[model samples]
Target: MRQANGDVRVGGPVNNRDVAEAHNYHAATKHSYWSVRLGGHFLDWANKPHPHKVYQGLPVVPLPCDVTPPTMAALEAVAAFPSMGTSIRNLAELAQVLFFCGGLTKKKVYPGGEAQYFRAASCTGGLYEIEIYAVCGDLPGLSAGVYHFCPADFALRRLRAGDLRGELARATADEESISDAPVILVLTAIFWRNAWKYQARAYRHFYWDAGTILANLLATAAATQLASRIVAGFIDTRVDRLLGLDSEREGSLCLVPIGAHSPAAEPSEVLPIAPETVPLSKREVDYPLITQIRAASMLLSEEEVRVWRSGFAPSPPPPINRKCFPLNTIKRDALPNRTLGEVIIRRGSTRQFAQLPISFRQLSTILERSSRGIPADFLGGSGTTLLDTYLVVNSVENLPTGAFYYSPSEQALELLKEGTFRRKAGYLCLEQGLGIEASVIIFFLADLDRILERYGNRGYGAAQLEAGIVGGKIYLCAYALGLGATGTTFYDDDVTEFFSPHAAGKAALFAVAIGHSARVPGRVKLLAPGAR
Candidate 1:
């Protein structure tokens, strides 16, 4: 599978057009320490794209204002993966889920005409590029239709007023979860929205940003007793066409089926749609690589989607001779008092950590609970994951400062090397101070050789996305315990090397820092009354 330029050749038996495209894109966009420094990329603030997507001709159906706030304890919500027996039968339940996933949560104004709007989850560069749409059957208060969620107005714009879930089910190859779903949420990304800042790398954020939002959405659904699972394998063009998307500028990324209902409506005639949308920017710069990668990863037909969804099981890691310190986790009954909704409303990326030691129990709870795994189509089963976690202990009580590997199978941490690597941790994380001061810096890595060999290039996205979802959970988990956490960028190669021998041949996928905040301020309440 190796190519001349060191790019993995993704054209074997399971490898298809999409796989090859992903490989080419990945090879071209990789970041080396020197490559990033010499790129000389500069942000053009004047050309920044509009954050919110608006449809001009559609009549809006205002969602129900009465949303039931979630009361489930934060840790319980993180650990809960309710069965598909539960259903979201009303508009109120749907409204609550959407609000917590993407609704505006906090607003702040700064001097010099600057303002920042925070959402339910964090995004890179604070650039909200992901847009959500819903396809569903008739519910208690909502009629069957295809609708776009407008976060700016908190309304759903009717794009096509009819049950379109059948089309989506077909697009996903009649995947049981989507076919049984009363409502399916389609997430898309507008290339220029984030590309304006990160350029071609924005492609990765397509999954990262969406994954973070999914973390919140999944938890919110579970808290409300609605069954939910993320569906990543689908016919990309079919989904885009169903949503009337112009694939050049914007494209579909994933489908999330929420709640269970009766069998899917019989496949219906898909009508042609070309709704007028407000232009995002005066001028937009096109990144060819982004489009190329998206096209390459797309499964072209329902048959192809079916074949693609036959995901491979990742091989278990090689055995190691090391003492494993099993996690000492608190039971659900003994979890912190704060609810998941409450924690999300107050969660923010820690700007500065106070170099203080956190209890070993706090760190262990985060690992044990968040690592229970996510419910997604790509994963083989519940509690199964594509990424392995590694941590650098900086200041956790009862834990010696060192680099360690977290064994999810054993629910324990295996000591890799014992030493004071605070300075090395900071350097690996691009010299960020948070890396040195945090109680623990967690890194998510994966064996790309095995991943790509088994699932092909699409597995690349599956790996990074799972990392973000897990990382986002860690963010919420830390906040529930009254500690602070933040996701950070890192020198990827350096991370694998820092945890070398144990993390040998594994590629770094994501990183998050957990610690006490330097400043403790009251959380700003932004939800409407009774709206969590």
Candidate 2:
């Protein structure tokens, strides 16, 4: 038995040349009417994995307590990106970025004193399985080292003692942004932490969970005046080894470099060290499919990474002169005055939604801010997003009750059909009222065939992560406008069919519902940042 990324498991790596494994894994994990009803999986509360990663007996580096978060308006922040060559930041600013990206925001106490400590970004099932690490050169108030961010206690523990940005450069094949960056943020996922609930499907959630955190990080970075870019192509084994990660238990998802214009370090020896870690649960169950898929998607060498990175090539362009509604964003003065930090603290998954209507301008504003473009490697220039947003409009002022297509580059909404879809919307979203009662539901659809062709098996993760990021941005935009929003799983094929013809050959990646909150009292107490 072999596993993905060369792990010891019950299967061999999926062959990328034929794309058989990519298609099979996606098809196997899809939710259908019968699949949801007959799938016998159940949560084992006794063995629920702990969310935090705790390393035993390590020196703690406490971040600055008085660091102030960026005060830019949330909407503005979403559209903001710093010019890459000019920005330089210190420790205090870095502290602020880490906090806003994954910091402890509030405590929600349910009945019987059951409590859930929510972080800055929204996560699926509130399982904070995504872990953030920073590798940096010496900066003001901080030293050069590889460090892991511990959100539970609001501090960092040095994982390796020395500057390793040069090592990151080598792993990424000297990606421009990464090579010159003062700091690189590496995001990884702990399998059992989420697999305890989602099983084999938890692999996809790795990127989804990280995507939400990234949405926050990008917005906060923009507001913090720090330039950042997402580097998706990297040698998996090298990066995992550099952080001393046990690749069987955890693997790097993506590398994000911050700031620039510094000299790139030459690659040095990468020694191995394994520090003991607190066990996540009393017992852990291995999901062989995850291991297999991970191994299949990995780039084994620098030459392979170079080829993978180069394949981002050009994505297809959108239709020209198509009849589309030109987006009408709310004037800056009328938009939310709330800052990025305030919006993040106030944001949460809306439980119930009212049938109240939201204005078209609000929807327009969301598209405008979120569509400015993600500074990412997978996306090439204009109209290169792997995902396309489709909407189920149930209750929106001046918009018909039907499905629609959104063109980010054109900044327009093209109506797919004009008819009531509330009942159909509910049925599609795994039968949830969150879909039926919302002002609009945004569904991200991607050409998996094209993505896989361009990015290899690993492109599967990239597509899913991109959806999660956009879904996250929609959440922030809705919250900034005092609306409720939630991410949901849907009957994958049904979504494609519902918006068919226009959505032909495209697969659904993720979905989000936005509208007025029902505000069911006492379910979970809300905590605003200033008061919390």
TM-score between candidate 2 and the true structure: 0.94
Q: Enumerate residue pairs that collide in model 1.
A: 18-296
Clashing pairs in 2: 4-295, 5-295
lDDT of 1 at 217: 89
TM-score of each: 0.93, 0.94
Please state the error at residue 391 of candidate 2 in Å. Answer: 0.5
For each candidate, the alpha-carbon lDDT, in order, equals 0.82, 0.83
Q: Write the per-residue lDDT of candidate 1 for residues 1-532, one digit (tens) a residue.
A: 0111222334433334435565556657766678689877788778678889989979888887666668888888887775454888888888888888888777655555456677888887888999999998999989998999987777899988878798888889899999999999999998889988877878887888888898888889888888889899888878998899989989998899888965668868987799999888888877776766666666777777777668667677656578667788766677788988888888888888999999888999999878887888888777788898999999988888898899888778888889998898888888889898888999999987777666667778878889889888998899999999998878877888888887888888889999999974434446552333
lDDT of 2 by residue, 1-532 (tens): 1222222334444544546667777887788999889877788899888989999887788887665867999998877754353445787777788888888787887767777888888887888889999998888977888899988777888888778888888888888899888888999999888878877778888988889888998998888778888888888888898888988889899998878777656767889989789989998788777877888888877777788777465455568344468888999878878889889877888889989999999999987887776778777743467888899999989877888888876778888788999999999999998888888999999888988887878899999998888888888899999888999889999999999888888888888999999866555544432223
Instruction: Output the lDDT of residue 389, model 2.
Output: 87
Off by over 4 Å in 1: 1-20, 111-113, 331-333, 520-532
